[model samples]
Target: MQNNRIRLLMLFITLLLPGIAMAASNAKENYGYYCVQCHGMKGNGMGLNIKDMSVQPRDHTDAKAMGARSDDEIFKVIKEGGQSISKSVLMPPWGDTFSDEEIHDLVKYLRSLCNCKLGG
Candidate 1:
Protein backbone atom coordinates (compact mmCIF):
# COMPACT_ATOMS: atom_id res chain seq x y z
CA MET A 1 0.00 0.00 0.00
CA GLN A 2 2.82 2.40 0.87
CA ASN A 3 4.65 1.69 -2.39
CA ASN A 4 1.48 2.14 -4.37
CA ARG A 5 0.88 5.54 -2.79
CA ILE A 6 4.40 6.69 -3.60
CA ARG A 7 4.06 5.51 -7.19
CA LEU A 8 0.80 7.37 -7.59
CA LEU A 9 2.36 10.54 -6.21
CA MET A 10 5.21 10.25 -8.69
CA LEU A 11 2.79 9.72 -11.51
CA PHE A 12 0.77 12.74 -10.45
CA ILE A 13 3.87 14.92 -10.46
CA THR A 14 4.88 13.64 -13.87
CA LEU A 15 1.46 14.40 -15.31
CA LEU A 16 1.08 17.78 -13.62
CA LEU A 17 4.53 19.10 -14.44
CA PRO A 18 3.87 19.72 -18.10
CA GLY A 19 0.65 21.56 -17.40
CA ILE A 20 2.27 23.87 -14.85
CA ALA A 21 4.79 24.94 -17.46
CA MET A 22 2.42 25.05 -20.39
CA ALA A 23 2.96 28.21 -22.40
CA ALA A 24 0.28 30.82 -22.37
CA SER A 25 -2.78 29.94 -24.44
CA ASN A 26 -3.26 30.53 -28.15
CA ALA A 27 -0.56 33.15 -28.77
CA LYS A 28 1.03 30.81 -31.27
CA GLU A 29 -2.28 30.04 -32.86
CA ASN A 30 -3.18 33.71 -32.95
CA TYR A 31 0.12 34.46 -34.62
CA GLY A 32 -0.66 31.80 -37.19
CA TYR A 33 -4.22 32.95 -37.68
CA TYR A 34 -3.52 36.69 -37.83
CA CYS A 35 0.06 37.83 -37.31
CA VAL A 36 2.16 35.25 -39.18
CA GLN A 37 2.50 37.30 -42.34
CA CYS A 38 4.18 40.25 -40.67
CA HIS A 39 5.17 39.50 -37.08
CA GLY A 40 6.38 35.95 -37.68
CA MET A 41 6.05 33.00 -35.27
CA LYS A 42 8.99 34.19 -33.21
CA GLY A 43 8.02 37.87 -33.40
CA ASN A 44 11.36 38.74 -34.93
CA GLY A 45 9.83 41.31 -37.29
CA MET A 46 10.75 39.05 -40.18
CA GLY A 47 7.47 37.59 -41.21
CA LEU A 48 6.89 36.33 -44.78
CA ASN A 49 5.37 39.52 -46.23
CA ILE A 50 7.39 41.99 -44.17
CA LYS A 51 9.98 42.65 -46.83
CA ASP A 52 7.47 44.16 -49.24
CA MET A 53 6.18 46.59 -46.62
CA SER A 54 7.48 50.08 -45.86
CA VAL A 55 7.75 49.54 -42.11
CA GLN A 56 8.92 46.46 -40.29
CA PRO A 57 6.87 44.84 -37.61
CA ARG A 58 7.91 45.22 -33.99
CA ASP A 59 10.28 42.56 -32.71
CA HIS A 60 8.59 41.05 -29.72
CA THR A 61 11.79 39.81 -28.15
CA ASP A 62 13.58 43.12 -28.38
CA ALA A 63 13.62 43.77 -24.67
CA LYS A 64 15.20 47.19 -24.95
CA ALA A 65 12.58 48.54 -27.30
CA MET A 66 9.51 47.05 -25.71
CA GLY A 67 10.60 47.96 -22.20
CA ALA A 68 10.00 51.68 -22.62
CA ARG A 69 6.35 51.21 -23.44
CA SER A 70 3.71 50.91 -20.70
CA ASP A 71 0.79 48.54 -20.44
CA ASP A 72 -1.64 51.31 -21.34
CA GLU A 73 0.48 52.18 -24.33
CA ILE A 74 0.59 48.61 -25.50
CA PHE A 75 -3.10 48.24 -24.79
CA LYS A 76 -3.90 51.31 -26.85
CA VAL A 77 -1.75 50.13 -29.68
CA ILE A 78 -3.47 46.79 -29.82
CA LYS A 79 -6.93 48.24 -29.49
CA GLU A 80 -6.68 51.38 -31.61
CA GLY A 81 -3.95 50.10 -33.98
CA GLY A 82 -0.28 50.95 -34.16
CA GLN A 83 -0.68 54.03 -36.33
CA SER A 84 -2.52 55.75 -33.53
CA ILE A 85 0.52 55.10 -31.39
CA SER A 86 2.79 56.35 -34.20
CA LYS A 87 3.82 52.85 -35.13
CA SER A 88 3.32 51.28 -38.54
CA VAL A 89 -0.20 51.63 -39.90
CA LEU A 90 -0.18 48.00 -40.89
CA MET A 91 -1.32 47.08 -37.40
CA PRO A 92 -5.04 47.29 -37.86
CA PRO A 93 -7.28 48.32 -35.00
CA TRP A 94 -8.67 45.29 -33.25
CA GLY A 95 -11.04 47.45 -31.25
CA ASP A 96 -13.99 46.62 -33.39
CA THR A 97 -12.98 43.04 -33.95
CA PHE A 98 -12.62 41.86 -30.36
CA SER A 99 -13.96 42.69 -26.96
CA ASP A 100 -11.93 44.63 -24.39
CA GLU A 101 -11.44 41.43 -22.43
CA GLU A 102 -10.14 39.66 -25.49
CA ILE A 103 -7.74 42.50 -26.12
CA HIS A 104 -6.48 42.19 -22.54
CA ASP A 105 -5.90 38.49 -23.06
CA LEU A 106 -4.01 39.21 -26.24
CA VAL A 107 -1.82 41.67 -24.40
CA LYS A 108 -1.05 39.11 -21.71
CA TYR A 109 -0.44 36.48 -24.34
CA LEU A 110 1.94 38.74 -26.23
CA ARG A 111 3.77 39.59 -23.04
CA SER A 112 4.25 35.91 -22.38
CA LEU A 113 5.90 35.37 -25.76
CA CYS A 114 8.30 38.24 -25.35
CA ASN A 115 8.90 37.16 -21.76
CA CYS A 116 8.36 40.85 -21.26
CA LYS A 117 6.06 43.01 -19.29
CA LEU A 118 4.97 46.44 -20.48
CA GLY A 119 7.45 48.19 -18.20
CA GLY A 120 9.88 45.38 -17.72
Candidate 2:
Protein backbone atom coordinates (compact mmCIF):
# COMPACT_ATOMS: atom_id res chain seq x y z
CA MET A 1 0.00 0.00 0.00
CA GLN A 2 2.81 2.41 0.93
CA ASN A 3 4.64 1.63 -2.28
CA ASN A 4 1.53 2.37 -4.28
CA ARG A 5 1.10 5.67 -2.47
CA ILE A 6 4.70 6.57 -3.18
CA ARG A 7 4.26 5.73 -6.82
CA LEU A 8 1.18 7.89 -7.01
CA LEU A 9 2.98 10.78 -5.37
CA MET A 10 5.88 10.39 -7.74
CA LEU A 11 3.59 10.34 -10.72
CA PHE A 12 1.77 13.44 -9.49
CA ILE A 13 5.04 15.29 -9.06
CA THR A 14 6.28 14.19 -12.43
CA LEU A 15 3.16 15.53 -14.09
CA LEU A 16 3.00 18.73 -12.09
CA LEU A 17 6.67 19.70 -12.33
CA PRO A 18 6.57 20.30 -16.06
CA GLY A 19 3.53 22.53 -15.76
CA ILE A 20 5.26 24.58 -13.07
CA ALA A 21 8.31 24.95 -15.28
CA MET A 22 6.17 25.94 -18.20
CA ALA A 23 4.33 28.53 -16.12
CA ALA A 24 7.60 30.04 -15.08
CA SER A 25 8.80 30.15 -18.67
CA ASN A 26 5.59 31.74 -19.84
CA ALA A 27 5.77 34.25 -17.00
CA LYS A 28 9.26 35.21 -18.11
CA GLU A 29 8.12 35.66 -21.65
CA ASN A 30 5.15 37.72 -20.52
CA TYR A 31 7.42 39.87 -18.45
CA GLY A 32 9.69 40.43 -21.41
CA TYR A 33 6.81 41.38 -23.65
CA TYR A 34 4.88 43.55 -21.22
CA CYS A 35 7.02 44.54 -18.27
CA VAL A 36 10.51 44.92 -19.66
CA GLN A 37 9.81 48.40 -20.91
CA CYS A 38 9.52 49.72 -17.35
CA HIS A 39 10.90 47.00 -15.10
CA GLY A 40 14.01 46.52 -17.19
CA MET A 41 15.43 43.35 -18.79
CA LYS A 42 17.27 42.54 -15.54
CA GLY A 43 14.28 43.31 -13.26
CA ASN A 44 16.36 46.06 -11.67
CA GLY A 45 13.91 48.95 -12.26
CA MET A 46 16.26 50.51 -14.76
CA GLY A 47 14.24 50.28 -17.92
CA LEU A 48 14.34 52.49 -20.99
CA ASN A 49 11.34 54.54 -19.87
CA ILE A 50 12.90 55.65 -16.59
CA LYS A 51 14.41 58.74 -18.10
CA ASP A 52 10.98 60.13 -18.88
CA MET A 53 9.22 58.93 -15.75
CA SER A 54 8.75 60.98 -12.60
CA VAL A 55 8.72 58.04 -10.22
CA GLN A 56 11.12 55.15 -10.38
CA PRO A 57 9.89 51.61 -10.85
CA ARG A 58 10.11 49.04 -8.13
CA ASP A 59 13.21 46.92 -8.21
CA HIS A 60 12.13 43.30 -8.45
CA THR A 61 15.64 42.15 -7.58
CA ASP A 62 15.49 43.72 -4.13
CA ALA A 63 14.81 40.71 -1.95
CA LYS A 64 14.43 42.71 1.22
CA ALA A 65 11.89 45.05 -0.29
CA MET A 66 10.10 42.40 -2.26
CA GLY A 67 9.87 40.16 0.78
CA ALA A 68 7.98 42.88 2.60
CA ARG A 69 5.17 42.80 0.06
CA SER A 70 2.68 39.97 0.20
CA ASP A 71 1.85 38.00 -2.91
CA ASP A 72 -1.68 39.41 -2.94
CA GLU A 73 -0.34 42.95 -2.95
CA ILE A 74 1.83 42.11 -5.90
CA PHE A 75 -1.12 40.63 -7.73
CA LYS A 76 -3.29 43.65 -7.06
CA VAL A 77 -0.55 46.04 -8.08
CA ILE A 78 -0.04 44.23 -11.33
CA LYS A 79 -3.71 43.81 -12.13
CA GLU A 80 -5.08 47.11 -10.87
CA GLY A 81 -1.92 49.16 -11.12
CA GLY A 82 0.28 50.66 -8.40
CA GLN A 83 -2.36 53.31 -7.70
CA SER A 84 -4.62 50.59 -6.36
CA ILE A 85 -2.25 50.24 -3.43
CA SER A 86 -1.58 53.98 -3.15
CA LYS A 87 1.79 53.47 -4.77
CA SER A 88 3.19 55.23 -7.80
CA VAL A 89 0.54 55.98 -10.39
CA LEU A 90 3.18 55.57 -13.03
CA MET A 91 2.64 51.82 -12.88
CA PRO A 92 -0.27 51.24 -15.19
CA PRO A 93 -2.93 48.60 -14.86
CA TRP A 94 -2.70 45.42 -16.92
CA GLY A 95 -6.11 44.07 -15.93
CA ASP A 96 -7.30 44.27 -19.48
CA THR A 97 -4.08 42.89 -20.88
CA PHE A 98 -3.31 39.86 -18.71
CA SER A 99 -5.45 37.13 -17.31
CA ASP A 100 -5.56 36.47 -13.55
CA GLU A 101 -3.46 33.35 -14.05
CA GLU A 102 -0.88 35.41 -15.89
CA ILE A 103 -0.81 37.94 -13.04
CA HIS A 104 -0.31 35.11 -10.56
CA ASP A 105 2.49 33.81 -12.73
CA LEU A 106 3.98 37.28 -12.74
CA VAL A 107 3.85 37.41 -8.94
CA LYS A 108 5.69 34.10 -8.87
CA TYR A 109 8.23 35.40 -11.35
CA LEU A 110 8.83 38.51 -9.25
CA ARG A 111 9.32 36.36 -6.17
CA SER A 112 11.82 34.27 -8.09
CA LEU A 113 13.65 37.39 -9.17
CA CYS A 114 13.93 38.57 -5.56
CA ASN A 115 14.53 35.04 -4.23
CA CYS A 116 12.37 35.85 -1.23
CA LYS A 117 8.98 35.21 0.31
CA LEU A 118 6.72 37.46 2.31
CA GLY A 119 7.09 37.41 6.11
CA GLY A 120 9.97 35.00 5.80
Candidate 3:
Protein backbone atom coordinates (compact mmCIF):
# COMPACT_ATOMS: atom_id res chain seq x y z
CA MET A 1 0.00 0.00 0.00
CA GLN A 2 2.84 2.41 0.78
CA ASN A 3 4.50 1.61 -2.55
CA ASN A 4 1.23 2.25 -4.36
CA ARG A 5 0.95 5.65 -2.63
CA ILE A 6 4.49 6.52 -3.66
CA ARG A 7 3.77 5.61 -7.25
CA LEU A 8 0.64 7.76 -7.21
CA LEU A 9 2.51 10.67 -5.75
CA MET A 10 5.18 10.35 -8.37
CA LEU A 11 2.60 10.22 -11.09
CA PHE A 12 0.93 13.30 -9.71
CA ILE A 13 4.17 15.21 -9.61
CA THR A 14 5.04 14.19 -13.14
CA LEU A 15 1.75 15.52 -14.42
CA LEU A 16 1.82 18.67 -12.31
CA LEU A 17 5.36 19.68 -13.14
CA PRO A 18 4.60 20.24 -16.79
CA GLY A 19 1.66 22.46 -16.00
CA ILE A 20 3.74 24.53 -13.63
CA ALA A 21 6.44 24.91 -16.26
CA MET A 22 3.84 25.88 -18.83
CA ALA A 23 2.43 28.53 -16.51
CA ALA A 24 5.86 30.04 -16.06
CA SER A 25 6.47 30.02 -19.80
CA ASN A 26 3.12 31.61 -20.47
CA ALA A 27 3.76 34.27 -17.87
CA LYS A 28 7.07 35.13 -19.51
CA GLU A 29 5.41 35.31 -22.90
CA ASN A 30 2.70 37.54 -21.52
CA TYR A 31 5.25 39.82 -19.96
CA GLY A 32 7.05 40.08 -23.29
CA TYR A 33 3.88 40.89 -25.13
CA TYR A 34 2.26 43.29 -22.68
CA CYS A 35 4.94 44.61 -20.35
CA VAL A 36 8.26 44.63 -22.23
CA GLN A 37 7.36 47.84 -24.06
CA CYS A 38 7.45 49.77 -20.80
CA HIS A 39 9.07 47.46 -18.27
CA GLY A 40 11.95 46.49 -20.62
CA MET A 41 13.00 43.08 -21.79
CA LYS A 42 15.10 42.61 -18.68
CA GLY A 43 12.42 44.17 -16.46
CA ASN A 44 14.78 47.04 -15.67
CA GLY A 45 12.24 49.70 -16.71
CA MET A 46 14.33 51.00 -19.57
CA GLY A 47 11.98 50.46 -22.46
CA LEU A 48 11.97 52.47 -25.65
CA ASN A 49 8.86 54.35 -24.53
CA ILE A 50 10.72 55.94 -21.63
CA LYS A 51 12.27 58.59 -23.86
CA ASP A 52 8.80 59.98 -24.54
CA MET A 53 7.23 59.44 -21.15
CA SER A 54 7.04 61.86 -18.25
CA VAL A 55 7.15 59.33 -15.44
CA GLN A 56 9.62 56.51 -15.36
CA PRO A 57 8.39 52.94 -15.27
CA ARG A 58 8.91 50.88 -12.15
CA ASP A 59 11.84 48.54 -12.45
CA HIS A 60 10.57 45.03 -11.93
CA THR A 61 14.08 43.93 -11.11
CA ASP A 62 14.18 46.21 -8.09
CA ALA A 63 14.04 43.63 -5.35
CA LYS A 64 13.54 46.13 -2.58
CA ALA A 65 10.65 47.89 -4.22
CA MET A 66 8.94 44.82 -5.54
CA GLY A 67 9.39 43.09 -2.21
CA ALA A 68 7.62 45.97 -0.49
CA ARG A 69 4.45 45.42 -2.47
CA SER A 70 2.08 42.61 -1.65
CA ASP A 71 0.88 40.16 -4.26
CA ASP A 72 -2.63 41.65 -4.14
CA GLU A 73 -1.29 45.13 -4.74
CA ILE A 74 0.53 43.93 -7.80
CA PHE A 75 -2.56 42.19 -9.10
CA LYS A 76 -4.73 45.25 -8.58
CA VAL A 77 -2.30 47.55 -10.33
CA ILE A 78 -2.04 45.19 -13.23
CA LYS A 79 -5.78 44.67 -13.53
CA GLU A 80 -7.22 48.06 -12.68
CA GLY A 81 -4.33 50.26 -13.74
CA GLY A 82 -1.81 52.11 -11.63
CA GLN A 83 -4.41 54.57 -10.43
CA SER A 84 -5.97 51.81 -8.41
CA ILE A 85 -2.85 51.80 -6.31
CA SER A 86 -2.39 55.60 -6.34
CA LYS A 87 0.36 55.26 -8.92
CA SER A 88 0.98 56.71 -12.37
CA VAL A 89 -1.97 57.01 -14.70
CA LEU A 90 0.20 55.92 -17.58
CA MET A 91 -0.15 52.32 -16.45
CA PRO A 92 -3.26 51.39 -18.33
CA PRO A 93 -5.90 48.95 -17.12
CA TRP A 94 -5.47 45.45 -18.47
CA GLY A 95 -8.53 43.94 -16.80
CA ASP A 96 -10.17 43.88 -20.16
CA THR A 97 -7.22 42.25 -21.80
CA PHE A 98 -6.46 39.51 -19.32
CA SER A 99 -8.45 37.25 -17.10
CA ASP A 100 -7.97 37.00 -13.34
CA GLU A 101 -5.88 33.88 -13.72
CA GLU A 102 -3.59 35.62 -16.17
CA ILE A 103 -3.16 38.51 -13.81
CA HIS A 104 -2.30 36.11 -10.99
CA ASP A 105 0.25 34.52 -13.25
CA LEU A 106 1.66 37.95 -13.96
CA VAL A 107 2.00 38.64 -10.24
CA LYS A 108 3.98 35.45 -9.89
CA TYR A 109 6.07 36.44 -12.87
CA LEU A 110 6.81 39.80 -11.29
CA ARG A 111 7.87 38.06 -8.10
CA SER A 112 10.24 35.90 -10.11
CA LEU A 113 11.72 38.96 -11.79
CA CYS A 114 12.45 40.61 -8.48
CA ASN A 115 13.64 37.39 -6.87
CA CYS A 116 12.17 38.51 -3.57
CA LYS A 117 8.98 38.46 -1.57
CA LEU A 118 7.19 40.68 0.89
CA GLY A 119 9.42 41.44 3.89
CA GLY A 120 12.25 39.52 2.33
Candidate 4:
Protein backbone atom coordinates (compact mmCIF):
# COMPACT_ATOMS: atom_id res chain seq x y z
CA MET A 1 0.00 0.00 0.00
CA GLN A 2 2.83 2.41 0.86
CA ASN A 3 4.57 1.72 -2.43
CA ASN A 4 1.36 2.18 -4.35
CA ARG A 5 0.66 5.46 -2.60
CA ILE A 6 4.15 6.70 -3.38
CA ARG A 7 3.76 5.79 -7.02
CA LEU A 8 0.38 7.49 -7.19
CA LEU A 9 1.76 10.67 -5.61
CA MET A 10 4.63 10.73 -8.07
CA LEU A 11 2.26 10.28 -10.94
CA PHE A 12 0.05 13.10 -9.70
CA ILE A 13 3.02 15.45 -9.38
CA THR A 14 4.30 14.60 -12.81
CA LEU A 15 0.92 15.37 -14.28
CA LEU A 16 0.59 18.65 -12.42
CA LEU A 17 4.09 19.91 -13.21
CA PRO A 18 3.52 20.24 -16.94
CA GLY A 19 0.61 22.65 -16.55
CA ILE A 20 2.70 24.95 -14.38
CA ALA A 21 5.54 24.82 -16.86
CA MET A 22 3.25 25.40 -19.80
CA ALA A 23 1.72 28.51 -18.18
CA ALA A 24 5.16 30.03 -17.76
CA SER A 25 6.12 29.04 -21.26
CA ASN A 26 2.96 30.59 -22.69
CA ALA A 27 3.61 33.82 -20.79
CA LYS A 28 7.13 33.93 -22.22
CA GLU A 29 5.77 33.46 -25.70
CA ASN A 30 3.24 36.25 -25.15
CA TYR A 31 5.98 38.56 -23.93
CA GLY A 32 8.14 37.75 -26.90
CA TYR A 33 5.35 38.44 -29.34
CA TYR A 34 4.11 41.71 -27.86
CA CYS A 35 6.71 43.15 -25.52
CA VAL A 36 10.12 42.09 -26.79
CA GLN A 37 10.23 44.87 -29.36
CA CYS A 38 10.27 47.47 -26.60
CA HIS A 39 11.12 45.54 -23.43
CA GLY A 40 13.72 43.31 -25.08
CA MET A 41 14.10 39.56 -24.66
CA LYS A 42 16.07 40.17 -21.47
CA GLY A 43 13.56 42.76 -20.19
CA ASN A 44 16.40 45.30 -19.98
CA GLY A 45 14.59 48.06 -21.92
CA MET A 46 17.21 47.89 -24.60
CA GLY A 47 14.91 46.84 -27.39
CA LEU A 48 15.40 47.42 -31.10
CA ASN A 49 13.35 50.62 -31.05
CA ILE A 50 15.15 52.23 -28.14
CA LYS A 51 16.99 54.71 -30.32
CA ASP A 52 13.88 55.99 -32.05
CA MET A 53 11.62 56.40 -29.06
CA SER A 54 11.57 59.70 -27.17
CA VAL A 55 10.94 57.98 -23.86
CA GLN A 56 12.84 54.96 -22.73
CA PRO A 57 10.84 51.84 -22.08
CA ARG A 58 10.71 50.71 -18.49
CA ASP A 59 13.23 48.01 -17.74
CA HIS A 60 11.24 45.05 -16.54
CA THR A 61 14.36 43.57 -14.98
CA ASP A 62 14.83 46.59 -12.70
CA ALA A 63 13.72 45.13 -9.40
CA LYS A 64 13.59 48.37 -7.50
CA ALA A 65 11.63 50.13 -10.18
CA MET A 66 9.28 47.30 -10.95
CA GLY A 67 8.69 46.59 -7.30
CA ALA A 68 7.40 50.12 -6.79
CA ARG A 69 4.39 49.44 -8.97
CA SER A 70 1.44 47.32 -7.93
CA ASP A 71 0.03 44.45 -9.95
CA ASP A 72 -3.17 46.38 -10.65
CA GLU A 73 -1.11 49.26 -11.97
CA ILE A 74 0.79 46.91 -14.20
CA PHE A 75 -2.41 45.28 -15.38
CA LYS A 76 -3.99 48.65 -16.11
CA VAL A 77 -1.06 49.79 -18.14
CA ILE A 78 -0.98 46.60 -20.14
CA LYS A 79 -4.69 46.50 -20.77
CA GLU A 80 -5.47 50.17 -21.22
CA GLY A 81 -2.08 51.36 -22.41
CA GLY A 82 0.47 53.47 -20.59
CA GLN A 83 -1.56 56.57 -21.26
CA SER A 84 -4.25 55.25 -18.96
CA ILE A 85 -1.81 55.71 -16.12
CA SER A 86 -0.49 59.02 -17.46
CA LYS A 87 2.53 57.29 -18.90
CA SER A 88 3.91 57.28 -22.42
CA VAL A 89 1.42 56.64 -25.16
CA LEU A 90 4.05 54.59 -26.87
CA MET A 91 2.86 51.62 -24.89
CA PRO A 92 -0.15 50.65 -26.90
CA PRO A 93 -3.32 49.19 -25.45
CA TRP A 94 -3.56 45.43 -25.57
CA GLY A 95 -7.04 45.16 -24.08
CA ASP A 96 -8.42 44.62 -27.52
CA THR A 97 -6.02 41.86 -28.33
CA PHE A 98 -5.76 39.80 -25.15
CA SER A 99 -8.14 38.55 -22.51
CA ASP A 100 -7.89 39.72 -18.89
CA GLU A 101 -6.49 36.34 -17.87
CA GLU A 102 -3.76 36.65 -20.46
CA ILE A 103 -2.94 40.17 -19.29
CA HIS A 104 -2.73 38.91 -15.73
CA ASP A 105 -0.38 36.18 -16.83
CA LEU A 106 1.78 38.77 -18.55
CA VAL A 107 1.86 40.81 -15.37
CA LYS A 108 2.95 37.74 -13.47
CA TYR A 109 5.65 37.11 -16.02
CA LEU A 110 6.84 40.71 -15.76
CA ARG A 111 7.04 40.38 -12.01
CA SER A 112 9.10 37.25 -12.52
CA LEU A 113 11.43 39.26 -14.69
CA CYS A 114 12.39 41.50 -11.80
CA ASN A 115 12.08 38.82 -9.13
CA CYS A 116 9.56 41.11 -7.51
CA LYS A 117 6.19 40.51 -5.90
CA LEU A 118 3.10 42.67 -5.87
CA GLY A 119 2.15 44.08 -2.51
CA GLY A 120 -1.34 43.68 -1.04
TM-score of each: 0.72, 0.86, 0.92, 0.86
State residue 60's C-alpha deviation in candidate 3, in Å: 0.5
Q: Which candidate leads the pack in lDDT?
A: 2
- Candidate 1, residue 18: lDDT: 74
Quantify all predictions' global Cα lDDT against the true fold.
0.76, 0.95, 0.94, 0.92
**Model 4 TM:** 0.86
TM-score leader: 3
Stretches of candidate 1 exceeding 4 Å from the true structure: 1-23
Q: What clash pairs does model 3 have? A: none
2 versus 4: better lDDT goes to:
2
Per-residue error for 40 in candidate 1, Å, reads 0.4
Q: Write the per-residue lDDT of candidate 2 for residues 43-101, one digit (tens) a residue.
A: 99999999999998999999999999999999999999989999999999999999999
User: Of the candidates numbered 1 and 4, which has the greater TM-score value?
Assistant: 4
Ranking by TM-score: 3, 2, 4, 1
Per-prediction CA RMSD (Å): 4.6, 2.2, 1.3, 2.2
lDDT of 3 by residue, 63-106 (tens): 99999999999999999999999999999999999999989999
